[model samples]
Target: MGKMIVRLWRRGFLSALNRGGDPHISDEDLTARARHLAARRHLVAEDGQTELTHALATGLHAATELLEEAGLSRRDARDRAGVAFLKSGQNLARWSMRLWLWVTPDPVGHAKAGNKLAERARMAWGSGLTVHQENGPDHATLMVTECVFVDYFWDAGRSDLTPILCAWDAQWMEIVNASDRPVSISRSGTLAQGCEACDFCFKRKAKLVYSAPFWDRLRGPGHGHG
Candidate 1:
């Protein structure tokens, strides 16, 4: 799983970097280098969580270093690298959103799916991740009051890196919005934005009614009410 992640990340990162005219090594070569860095930093643990999290951090950190060598500032390096990383994972991220749309098929069910994924994250990272969940018949909100990656990058004096992590969550929300599905997801804040928690707000889109006024009829079907 660790190596698999590195491969995907390198694919995205390399693609983005190359598009900017900053050449990158092949994915196979980059992946090998990143895995070595993770191992050297003692970030790979037997249970695999360390590799799952820190190993990617290790790769991103390397990307920053490489970009810095190409004349980018530390902040610029981090922002660019983070963007590349997010770009790399978009397809995989869409799968879950698509799955939820297929499985839940309603606003309430969508909210439940979001709640469950938050709970799953809580279990995956233990203290590193924290989820404060709220669910209703038509809406659900999952807030992350604490996050390991936010704390980690901040402690490393690179709080800028945290937003890249936040963008991953953003991708999921964006996917739902792009779909014609009646359910939509949103967020008002993230720990990266100095909020107390990152909010994942999912609500059912209002369905259009045919029996409404003529003006409403011209407007046709819509996401009902927000």
Candidate 2:
């Protein structure tokens, strides 16, 4: 996972930098940039999930800085970084969701699968997750009161990036629900926005008529869509 993240970050960063007439950024320079951002953000490359998340955050921070160096404003640079990161992982996200749907053939199975995965993730991060699970015949909901990503970014003074991470959840869920046995997620509040908790309600539906425009919206003209 760590190596994959590094590759993703490198690819995304170079892709963004290429737009400014230079794709020849050296690997050493990129690594130095990420290390610099990690230092600025107080992110340590600890073991397990800490290392993974911090690496991603550092890479994203570096990407933003590179974009800014290319003459974009801070806001625009961050926006571009978010889009680049998302686009880089879209294929993986889709494949993972499809595999999950294949393994969990029914609503109950799907809910259980989700719970197991969430538990593993929580254990990996080792902090900042409070989950409540409610399961019914046709639905399952996971109410998260505290999110480690939100806490980590907030403490790092990069809380603005939390929404970009939250948007990935919506994107992945959208991919999952696109399966035959559609399971839709309804989220109202988010810790990123200073809400008490993130209310994620996943319900089984015969036909879910919803489209996630997160990517398109984020890539739009202005940051209004964010």
Candidate 3:
């Protein structure tokens, strides 16, 4: 992650922590915990990762450690980090989604572009992104057919943390499912969740309603964004 992304993620993480954190765990303590995690290079996933994915792996691994050190259960730490990561990336994710939607308005076209994007991403991540069944004008599925992190986390005995990386897509998917967009992305299963793949199902809405633009609708929850 870049300095800016880390800063944003940190901000969001703190906010998420404060909302329902243990009464004993102060904001300063969590901030310091995150800072300590960020201070060093924590190597969790070594191979089959891009610089970005490597950062995600190490960051998740580090957060797992820090949270554990802070007396959180493994599940709570990952879930909490997942939520914070989702909040942190919402802005850019929405904008990229808006731009992608603009370029490929129709669901089928957008699905094709998603395929290309996955292909390009594979060059970096060392795993394939499978965009399946673009034949449907309004429905498609995108998934990590082979996620590199599977092995890394499994080896580290921290596969539970893999879902935190999956959080990167949660915001964009939410945008797709938002009212303004003509499409809907749904994925109830994930590789980290013990599913065969991290599936993101894209479906076009049967009808379009223009109450408020999705961007404007997004502006509220998107506020105080990290």
Error (Å) of candidate 2 at residue 24 is 7.5
Give residue 28's error in model 1 in angstroms: 8.5
Instruction: Please give, for residues 81-190, the per-residue lDDT of candidate 2 as tens digits.
Output: 78767776677679877776654535444575657535644765544467767666777667788876787677767787788878877887787656554466678878
Question: What is the C-alpha lDDT profile of model 1 across 1-226, one tens digit per residue?
Answer: 6557645656666887556555454566556666676666555354455545665565676677677777888877777787788877788788966776654536456447647757766655655667878887778787788886786667656677777888877898898888766767788888888888888877766665112333344667893232
Query: TM-score of the candidate numbered 3?
Result: 0.63
Candidate 3: which stretches are off by over 4 Å?
A: 1-49, 123-134, 207-226
Instruction: Assess candidate 1 and give its TM-score to the true structure.
Output: 0.75
TM-score of each: 0.75, 0.74, 0.63
Let me know the TM-score candidate 2 reaches against the reference structure. 0.74
Better-scoring candidate (TM-score), 1 or 3: 1
Comparing candidate 2 with candidate 3, which one achieves the higher TM-score?
2
Q: Tell me which residue pairs clash in candidate 1.
A: 206-223, 206-224, 206-225, 207-224
Q: Would you list the rank order by TM-score, best first?
A: 1, 2, 3
Best first by lDDT, ranked:
1, 2, 3
C-alpha RMSD by candidate, in order: 5.9, 10.1, 8.0
Assess the local accuracy of residue 71 in candidate 3 as a C-alpha lDDT between 0 and 100: 83
